[model samples]
Target: MGQLFESVVMAVKAIFQNKTRAFLTMLGIIIGILSVSLMGTAISGIDQVFEKSIESMGQDVLYVEKFPWFMMNDDWWEYRNRPNIEEEYAQQILDRSSTIAFASPSSSRRADVKYGTQAVEAVEINGTTWQEAFITSVKLESGRFFSELEDRYGTRVAVIGYDIKKNLFPDEDPLGNYIMINGNKFRVIGVIAEQGKFLGLMSMDNIVTVPLKAMKSVFGRLRRISISVRPKEGYTVDQAKEELTFIMRGLRKLKPREADNFAINQQEAFRQQFSNIRFAISAVGLGITALSLIVGGIGIMNIMFVSVRERTKEIGIRKAVGAKKSIILFQFLSEAIIISLIGGIIGILITVALVGVVQKFFVAQLSFSLVLISLSVAVLTGIISGIVPANQAARLNPIDAIRYE
Candidate 1:
């Protein structure tokens, strides 16, 4: 161990002696490691954000929809095949499912909201129940959410998003303020808590929700509705799913073996889908990183060969003085490893710093696993690249080498 440490120290000193040459030699490795680490960090951060978003949606609640969120095929063929998920069907499921706490059918429409001279355009107007705001974590920052009694009375009250509140009512309280949906007057009842932005594009805060009855009154017909249902506490998720499926199947009046019309989307499904995508991304990144390492290895091998040729007389003299072949081999190999490792360390630091800067601005998070993996790959590359040169140095003919010099 002591001998190995001494050899490593010597290798490091050699690296610093010709710093520019060493750095140039390690260019490929540095870029490769940096690319991989940065990609890994970004991927990890995105995965974390997705996970947090799903978790915030509540594990007990299932997001039932006709089409999966990440499905690639959104064309006519897929859409036609998908069963129509209507409000009536959602209600039937709610009535039949014994394991469910509350099931609410929701639908959205994007339209311009007018508040006297002020106007907010293309805002998502979500039509859902009072239970939706409570069960699906739609917290209010101020004012009051519409009650079940108000919903039953078909009240034209609106709950604005945090951004909407800021846009429409900057100076004053928005509650009980009258607003128009393309001309029809509605009262502002509540404002939602700030949910920031998703993917730096869509702001969750830039939405407004109204009761289902009010929406039907204003919009004049809703064919589809998303059902959000929470399983009762103390029940396993699978058990809840089974019960809900059974209830849905019964409500749809399908045969025991027949496929049901409604779909049950859960938090775990999103987790699995997102996790699979991330894994695929990581795999592609690893493959590319491997290719870069291979190229860098070739460069190392070429440089080591040149080094060995330049030091042929030294090798011969050392061998004449009883320096073993193993020691020579170890020295060359250690040099290669040192060069790659220095590059790797620098790459890891740069990537980590970049990730830190990104995390400061974004809600996502990057982790240390990226650095660990990149460093490991670099070390492995060094070992692989050094092997041939080390072996050649070890097997040098001392008499012939001395005669040539």
Candidate 2:
């Protein structure tokens, strides 16, 4: 153990003595390890962000809509030709399906909400029943959500999103306060909990939800609804979907051979789609990160070869003093390993800090668990890069090595 410690100390001194060369040699390992570490951290962060967003919208809930939520691409004309699905159909399907526990129809429109002289423009106005809030796992931060009685009565009451509440009523209570939408005056019934935005598109905190019946009265001729469904405790989601399909098919009067008019949005389906995207992103990151490591390894190899040439006389003198070839090999190998290990530590620190900075925008946090992986790869790279040169130095004839200039 003492001898090993002495060898490591000597390697450290040699590195400091040739500081510029040592740093130049370490640059490749540093960059390679850093790239891979950063990539792993970044990918992990993105996955967490996606999971949090999905979780915010209840994991057990599924949707039944006319159009697919995540289609690759569809023609505008095709969308125009699509028939409008009715809310009554969703209720009929829910009533008929034994596997389903509860279901509700949801619709959305863009509207400007005005509070006194202030106006929040282009806020998404959602039309849903009281059950919709429970299905979406939406919790009221203040006041109360619209009751079934309110929906049945078509009351002109609205639930404001957290951001909307903040913007419109910074100090005062939003509940019972009237907000004007176009010419309609609606009383704020509740303020939703602050939820973060998703994919840089929509702000989850900036939406307003009102009763479906009241929305239909104001907007007129409501066509489609975003239906949320929950499966019964004993039944799997697939069974619920199957039963739902049968009910919808019968309701639409479609023949067994004909294609169904509606689409089912399952949570598992979103998970699968997101998983595919995550895998693709991981593959690309790994590929790029691997290239960096490979380049660094090559750099280490080149420097090691030069190091062997420069230390030829030292090896000869050691061999003459009864030092074995293994000692000479170990010395050079240890030096390379030290450089890589130090670089790996630095890389990890930087990568972690970067990931932290990126997570600030989201309500959720990012996590990394690739420290062991980075260290292993770093040490392995160092040993592999040093092998050829270490072997060459060890095999050198002492007599010839001593005589060489």
Candidate 3:
């Protein structure tokens, strides 16, 4: 312990002797740490956003659609030719499938909405049954979702999204107010809660929903629709999917040898797709980090060699005065570590400051684990880069080194 302390003191003195050189040597480490840490922060932010978006999407729900969310074979044209998912399949799934607890058929179209003089354009108008409220995780900010009776009656009542409420009824209570959609007067019954953005690209809250009956008349029954399905409380997604598939195949009247022309989409499939995205981002980050750290490590190694040469006479003098070879090695190693660690600390501080600005635009998170990772990498780089130069310094003969000057 005492020897290590003395070595650290020696290292500090040597660093101060040429402060500019020490700082310059630390530059590589600083940049390396900064690049890697920022990459981690960006990845973490993406993960956070993904998790939140997934939660809003409901973890257990399934979508019966004409096309899969991810086409494994890149055969999109094959799937495009498949028939549209019928809206009535939602009821069939609920009635025939033991695994299904709730099902809601929904369709969407972009249209303009107006409340008196205020207007919002390109708003998504959703048409679904009352059961949709049970399958989705979206919460109502005010009033309540339309009831089964309202859906049966094809009432003109609509539930507006948070953004629409803000845009069209900025000063007044949106409830009980009438909004014009496709030149049709619809009364606002509820406001969907704010759901932020979906995948950070589109706003989930920019929507208006009405009953499927009304939706057919407003958007036309000619358009195809998808059905949302939720599994029974204790049923696995696979079990639910199997039941759904069986019913859909039967409903489509597919012959024993004929392939069914439908897609069953679930959160798990979405997760797999997102995992691929994460892997892609990680690969890029790893490449950048590897390059930066390697350059930084090389820089440190070169500087340590120069340092060993400059301190040879001093090493010999200390050895002559009873300094062990281990002490000399420790001294150089500690110096490298300190420089690298200081650089890492500076990088972390920089990351912390930038995290706030990043969140304002998108999402960036600086976590404690990420800091630990940066520091560990910095320290590891120091140790690896310093070892050979430190060993060379330790192996020098006192008589030869003293005579070198």
Query: How many steric clashes between backbone atoms does each model show?
Result: 0, 0, 0
Error of 3 at 374 (Å): 1.0
Model 3 spans with C-alpha error above 4 angstroms: 1-3
Cα lDDT tens digits for candidate 2, 79-144 = 446566778876797778898887888899888999998899988889988788767777889889
| Model 1 weakest 10-residue run by lDDT | 71-80
Model-by-model lDDT, in order?
0.79, 0.80, 0.89
Each model's TM-score? 0.86, 0.91, 0.94
* Model 2 ranges with Cα > 4 A deviation: 74-80, 199-201, 360-368
Q: What are the clashing pairs of model 1?
A: none
Best by TM-score: 3
Which window of ten consecutive residues has the lowest lDDT sum in model 2? 360-369
Better structure of 2 and 3 per TM-score = 3
Index of the highest-lDDT prediction: 3
Model 3 Cα lDDT, one tens digit per residue, 156-261: 8999999999999889999998999988999999999999998776899899999989877877763658899999999988889888889999999998898879
Residue range 1-405, candidate 1, lDDT tens digits: 676676677667767877888888898788789778877776867766676576557667876677656556645465558667777665677677777777888899899988878999999989888778656766789988889888878799999999888998999899989988857788998998887666434678878888888988989887567888877777777877888777766766799787655568887777788778788888887787777778888888888887778778877876787768888788889899888988899888777677778777765444666667788889888889988987787789999766655
What's the true lDDT of residue 110 in model 2?
86
C-alpha lDDT of residue 112 in model 3? 95
